[model samples]
Target: MSTDNSEHMRTIDRWLAGEVVNNTIGIKVVGGPFDGRTKIVLLGEDGRPPAVIRASGGPAGPSRHAYEAVRSTDVRAGWIYTYTGPEPATES
Candidate 1:
């Protein structure tokens, strides 16, 4: 991997490790802006969790996921600014 990519992963790792997104519930990961990359962004309801996660391979990067809790008088923006991966899976 290149230096830029390395730095990107490192930074993302640190953020993931920190108090950004929570793992309380299973997350939904999707592809990212960059190729071979995936990311998850959270816009907490009522102004709570607003975090971003982006990862790539290099030792192979990790998958990303985010979830938002619902609250009255608030609308989550996570869906608005998230990566649109390939089509969803469906049962035949």
Candidate 2:
């Protein structure tokens, strides 16, 4: 799995299927209505990108200029959506 933490990586015995993990670039989208949408996860207080993405050209937000510019290139940058699911029950 893609993790954003600097902690030493280690193998574990077991884990819950839906257990929240580190946040990072989970998925990359290319085409369709939602283009350049990357899944940046947020597991508790963990996870953060090393640097911000700088677009060589085009305006910010959903714009034809940005979309076309990104579509023309082999690949570019766009938006990032944080991933979150129903929080597991916590002990009170």
Q: Each prediction's Cα lDDT score?
A: 0.38, 0.30
TM-score of 1: 0.26
The sequence of per-residue lDDT tens digits that candidate 1 reaches over residues 1-91 is: 9999998777667444332434321233333434323234443564344444433333323433332222322222222224433233346
Instruction: Give Cα distance to truth, residue 82, candidate 2, Å.
Output: 18
Per-residue lDDT of candidate 2, residues 11-78 (tens digit): 11111121224433333333433444543333334333322232222233332221121212332222
lDDT agreement of model 1 with the native: 0.38
What's every prediction's RMSD, in angstroms? 12.0, 16.2
Error (Å) of candidate 2 at residue 85 is 24
Top candidate on lDDT is 1
Clashes of 1: 3
Task: Show how many residue pairs clash in every candidate, following the order shown.
Answer: 3, 0
